[model samples]
Every structure is written in C-alpha cells, then in structure tokens.
Target: MSDALAYDVFAKTCPSRGTLEHVTGRWGGLILGALHEGTFRFNELRRRVDGVSEKMLSQTLHALERDGLVHRDAQPTNPPRVDYRLTPLGHEVAGQLLGLIRLVEGRMDRVLAAREAYDAEHEPVTGRTA
Candidate 1:
C-alpha cells in the first residue's frame, strides 16, 4: 500500500473537519458558489456573496485559499488587481454544494410548511409565538 495518509472527515482528530467547515460554513459555501460562476475581484466577490463584512470575507478567502480550494491571482499595475477563482478540487466541491443549494431552494415550500407545522405544534397556548 502507498504511504499516503488517508483522511476521514468524520474522525474527531482528522484535519478534513477544518476543510469541511471552511467549505460549508455560512460564508465559505456562498463564496465557493459565487466563484464557480467565474473569477471575481475581492469587491465583486463581496457583492456577490452579499451581507458578508469585508473583514469576514477576507478571512474566509484566506482560509479557502489555504485549503487549496481557491486560487488568488495578483497582478501588478498602477493599482494592484486581485482575482479569486476555484481550483479543480474547488470546482468539484462547489458543484456538489450547488446541488445541495438547489435542492434546498427547490424544496422551500415543503420546508416552510414543515416549519409552520412544527411551530404550530410546539407553540405555547399564550399565542405569543416562539
């Protein structure tokens, strides 16, 4: 057998957990999904993944880049230009995430109904709504 170490994401001590978190975290998934469309500048990516603060976006991008799921290209000009895109691995992962995203979006009606039913069943008699 090859000496390459295998990673199991479910293992408590495995490093894959951190990468998984970076890929699935609130901002990470959105960033990856946005980048899957095309390469984008920092500000453009920020706008694409709305509601993310500049600092948070920067941090998330750095984490994703470190995980080799993102490629950061810097160009030297009168003003520096930076673009972010997905690596091959990132593209594969992003495709999977997009599938999940689409599934959730397509089933929102059912999800909303389920939520309402759950709330109705669990709500207090006072009717203040939880």
Candidate 2:
C-alpha cells in the first residue's frame, strides 16, 4: 500500500505557513486586485494606487511574477513600455482574494467600532504620559 500524503496550515514551521501572509500582504493583495481588470503600464499603476513607492511596486511585481501570479511584459517600443497582467492561475487566486476583501468590507464597520471601543475602554486617563 502507498503512504498517504499530508498537509497542515496550522504549524508555524510549515513551509507554506507564510504563503498566505505573502499573498495577502498589503501590496500583494492590492496589486493583484488592480491587475484583474487589465494590464497596466508601470507609471499608470503607480498613479492608480496611492502611497506605494515605485521601488516597492517594482519589487511586488517581481515577487508576483516569480510566484506565477503576474506576467510582466516589456515591449520593444520607442518609449520602452512595460506592463503587468495576471495569468489564468492568477485570475483564480485573485478571485479568491477578492472574496477576502469583500468579507473585510462587509464587516469593516463593526471591526472599526470594536477597535474604537477597545481603545476608549483601555486608554490610561491619568497614567504615564509617555
């Protein structure tokens, strides 16, 4: 008889334990969602998203491309244009990703309210200033 294969996400030592964090990181999630509509030129993407530095964007793109989620195209043109798009696999992953986003958006108000209440209830009124 053949041995059964196994996998678990709970153990911190698991190789894939950090994968979810990587795929769902601040830049990764946003970049994937943005690329869903269509390919975007480097500068156009920079303008579309607020607060992402150019270097970070480049690095994020490189990571996604390495993971087979994003495709980078550099055209031989006068202006030297480069754009990014999602692979078919990326579409599947990104759709699941959007699900997480929708979940967050639906419950964000409650989450924020809870955080506010926690802060108000826990703040030291007359404790150490620093």
Candidate 3:
C-alpha cells in the first residue's frame, strides 16, 4: 500500500510474481472469467469453469480472494451457501484477460497454420509421427 514500494514482477523475490501467477494461471483465469459474468455459488462456478477439479477450483479461489481480486461470501443457512464474484479489481483484470482471449480465439486459424508449419518442419527431427 506504500507508493514508495515498487513491484517488479520479473524479480525473483517479488510478491507480485505470485499474484500475477494467481491471476493468469490456467484455473485462475478461467475462474475470474466465469465470475466476471456474475456471482456464482461454488458448484455453479465449478460447472461454469468446466474442467476444473474441486480442489483446484477451491485453491484458485482462495488465492484470488487473498489477492483482493475475488470476493467470497458465506451465508449462514441450514445448508450454508457460499458465493464467489469479482471485486472491482477482479473485474478490471478479467476485462483485460477477456480481450486477450477474444484475440486468440479470433486468430486461431493463423495460430493453427503456424503450428502446422512448425510441426511439419520439425516432425522428423522430433520423432513425432503425423
């Protein structure tokens, strides 16, 4: 919270590196993106994120929550309900990620072509079949 304290993500000991990893890692990004749509209970979020296992989802959510990007609400009911949503900071980060996702998706054809060309050129050396 100090303006004098600078964060260099590339630095080996930088705390920002951990936060960046939490925000951009596989499960983290998907969790944030899904939460960007709206608030969701744990199971709902799990379903929305598709392939995330319960443990991974729980861990990612905890990390994001600690980073102040995700908000977790626990309601006391006969069957307790917990909901997850993006904080203002989370929304900002998710918005940027969504743009990157859209760009990659839109350019998939070019990406696939490049991959094919690279694979074709290296297949023999790599001992990869097909």
User: For all candidates, what are the clash counts?
Assistant: 0, 0, 0
* Per-residue lDDT of 13 in model 3: 93
TM-score of each: 0.91, 0.83, 0.91
The best candidate by lDDT is 1
Superposed by TM-score, candidate 1 places the C-alpha of residue 10 at a distance from the truth, in angstroms, of 1.6
lDDT of 1 by residue, 16-125 (tens): 89999999998999999999999999999999998999999999999999999999999997699999999999999999999999999999999999999999999877
Which pairs of residues have clashing backbones in candidate 3?
none
For model 2, the local distance difference test gives 0.83
- Please give the ranking of all candidate structures by lDDT, highest first, separated by commas: 1, 3, 2
* Per-residue alpha-carbon lDDT of candidate 2 for residues 3-109, written as tens digits (9 for 90 to 100): 32343557777545555565788888888888887889988888776778999899888888888889999999998989899999889888999898889999999
Better of 2 and 3 by lDDT: 3
Off by over 4 Å in 1: 1-5, 127-130
Q: State the lDDT at 24 in candidate 2.
A: 82
Question: Runs in model 2 with CA error above 4 Å?
Answer: 1-19, 127-130
